[model samples]
Target: MTRALVIVDIQNDYFPGGAFPLVEPEAAAANAAEVLGAFRAAGEPVVHIQHVSADPEATFMRRGSHGDEIHELVAPAAGEIVLQKAHPNSFLGTHLESTLRDLGADEVVVLGMMSSMCVDATVRAASDLGFDVTVVHDACAAPDLEFGGTSIPGGAVHAAFMAALSDSYATVVPAARLAQTH
Candidate 1:
């Protein structure tokens, strides 16, 4: 079975001090870069999913903004596949399914921004679309949440999401483990 790497929304807007900063965005970007490198080395397909917010007031990532561009630290290679998406789920109204099909990909390694949202959405969507999904926990981030008048730590949210996701949508694994799998 062919496998592809789906990098979702590693854009400038999601980085620290950017439009919509996430927890440890820098680290996520670094791990994602390593994942990309591994995929390249293995001659596997790499798909870069760029999310552009159609909503103007949506923190950052407005259409045509620099924030919508791929983060400098995790830039894609010349021939890497790029899919521009308007929604959190990469498959929503996008050519993601067809693109993956054309590449003959039966499995996908997913990594990117906003662990509790886009990352999760993509994983679920991929699973629904019949792809074996592997989500790299260390290569994803989420904003801190607030519950019962207390701010939930980013790490807690990240871990909780990973635990939940492992049950159904995807197999949650550390970046190192996923990298070594190739």
Candidate 2:
């Protein structure tokens, strides 16, 4: 089975000094970069999914903004595919599915910023789309979120989402395990 690495939303906005920074963004980006290097070395296909907000009210990642660009740590090399997506699910309203099909990818390794959002959505969607999905737990990050009257810690949120995803949507693993697979 062919495997593809799908790096989702490793954008400047998720890092320090940018709007909507994520928890441990640097560490997550570093892990993602490691996975990217493994995939590149193995001659596997890599797809970088960039989230560009179309809503004017969006605080970060607005189209044409520097924050919307892919972060330097895990930036796509030439000949790599960079897909722009507006929705949290990368395949929605994007060419991601077609691109994956064209690349003959039957399994996909997913990682990136905002584990509770983009990563969560994309993994579930990828499963529904019939792709065997694997999420790199340490390669994704999420910021603290406030709900009702309580604040949920970012690490807790990330762990909960990853756990939930592993229950049905995708297989959750570490970057090291992914490298072993390749």
Candidate 3:
């Protein structure tokens, strides 16, 4: 099966000293970089999805800002595709679906920042679009969230989202498993 690696929103804003930092962001980026290397070595298609917020009131990921750029460790190569998006779903308001289609990608290996939001949205959307998806759990990160005065740790939030997606929206695996697959 033809497969593509979709690296979503591994931007500066999610890292340390950026606008919005996620839990274990550096470690997650390293994991993603490792997976990216595997895909590159295997001659697979790799697409980088960048989130550029259009809202003027957005605190992070403001368009044209330094934090809006993808992190250097996992930045796209010259021939690789870089897609800018304004929504949680990468396929929405972007050429992600068409690009995948053109690359003959029936399966996608996904990883990146904000697991509870972008990763969750993209995996479900990919499933709805009829593409098989494999989400690298360790390669994704999320920040702690608060709801009704209760604080949810980032790790818990990440695990919950991965668990929800597993066996339903996508097969959630680790970076090592991804290497094995390649």
Backbone clashes for every candidate come to 1, 0, 0
Q: Tell me the tens digit of each residue's lDDT in model 2 across 102-176.
A: 999999999997899899999999999999999999999999999999999999999999999999989899988
How accurate locally, in lDDT, is each candidate?
A: 0.90, 0.93, 0.95
For lDDT, candidate 1 versus 2, the one ahead is 2
- After superposition, the stretches of candidate 3 with alpha carbons farther than 4 Å from their true spots are none
lDDT of 1 by residue, 1-182 (tens): 99999999999987766877888899988998888888999999999999987887877889888889999767888998899998889999899999999999999999998888899899999999999999999999998999899999888998898888899888888888878977
TM-scores for candidates 1 onward, in order: 0.95, 0.97, 0.98
Ranking by TM-score: 3, 2, 1
**Candidate 3 residue-wise lDDT, 76-130, digit = tens:** 9989999999999999999999999999999999999899999999999999999
Cα RMSD for predicted model 3: 0.8
- Could you arrange the candidates by lDDT from highest to lowest? 3, 2, 1
